[model samples]
Target: MESSMKKPAPDQHDFHFWTDEKFRIADTDLNGHINNNAVGQFYEAGRGEIISSVLGPPAKRSIGAALARVQIDYLAEAHYPGMARIGSRIARLGTSSITIAQAIFVEGRCIGMAESVIVFLDKATRKPTPMPDAVRDGFTLLG
Candidate 1:
């Protein structure tokens, strides 16, 4: 369990991520609002985008030895074909993984929050890998 994040605040350094997304017509379930699964998908995409920007795409056949425990909180409702903007930040860093916190907003309205615990993994053994230098630098708060 080795962590790469030195600082707790990702915003202190103006480190922020914004991605434009629109709800698909198929996202709506019988309830009308976005489906339960959709929320998690949106959050994952946002978080993945942040990491991918630095590491390119994760090695599919060889992902870093890491497992993610994801938790999502829904605050408001979203409609299909609606626009959503996701913001990502780092909340905490443990010995082996980092906890990233993300929020989904539509036209400035807070709809939900998603948190994920991502571990750095070794491609060879699928075991937790020591934080790499490049990843460590990428996760560094902007400041």
Candidate 2:
């Protein structure tokens, strides 16, 4: 059966983590607009920040999460040599995974948005595992 899943919209109020990153000349394509890969990288950085804040230091945590899927939508072109504001938040939580919603804005205008699924896993086995209560509570507070 076909599933009906809709993309999430950019909502500033939904995000708890925010960061600003400057785009370099290398990030732009021949067209002088930021490349799709660079946009994804920005989102990844935002996710990493959120994970660190919610789950503690990577070196201290025994269990970690892995990126399972990512869906990004490009709405406008972003030029290089400018700063982009990134925002991220927890959109959904499951027994062993969480969905992160993120957006990229250039000069106060949204240029792209993304949703990513990350699965909690055992460090030794690299298999899915239930999220700890503390982690779940942390997500709740951020959400």
Candidate 3:
């Protein structure tokens, strides 16, 4: 559980960014295709970038916080030695948590998509905390 809350369905409009990632040899699996885990990793990169931008610093654990949920959908296949472009957007921003949606595209086609809900918490008590103003400011929609 990520504290008490409700989350609406995620939509296309939730995406707000794009990131480019180069595939490495280790990123491939025995099948000679990019591992499924790579897709989620790219999504996480995008989320970290956005969170850092909003917080005026690099993204971290935010004291006692941690990733709460991750839902991924694989659409197509990704080959090795290719480029992965990741796109991201905020779907939900709650009092103590935020939901982000991300998509992985290779060779101009979507290969995967993921949604993650991350929570903020008090470092000492490990309880949910209000999203700091600095962090919320990065979400233009809420302004």
**lDDT of candidate 2 over 20-60, digit per residue (tens):** 89998989998999998889889999999898888878888
Q: Compose the digit string of candidate 1's lDDT tens values, residues 1-143.
A: 95675323222123277777889978888989889887877887877787676567775523463447887767779988788788887677665577877778876777777778888776767778666666667666611
The global C-alpha lDDT for each of the candidates, from Candidate 1 onward, is 0.71, 0.87, 0.74
Q: What is the lDDT, from 0 to 100, of the residue 80 in candidate 1?
A: 83
The collision pairs in model 3 are: 14-89, 15-89, 16-88, 16-89
Candidate 3, 1-143: lDDT as tens digits: 57565344334344557789999888888998888777778888877776665654533545445689998877778887889888787778898888877877787677788888988788778898998786676665522
Show where candidate 3 strays beyond 4 Å. 1-14, 58-64, 141-143
Off by over 4 Å in 2: 1-9
Error of 1 at 47 (Å): 1.5
For TM-score, the strongest prediction is 2
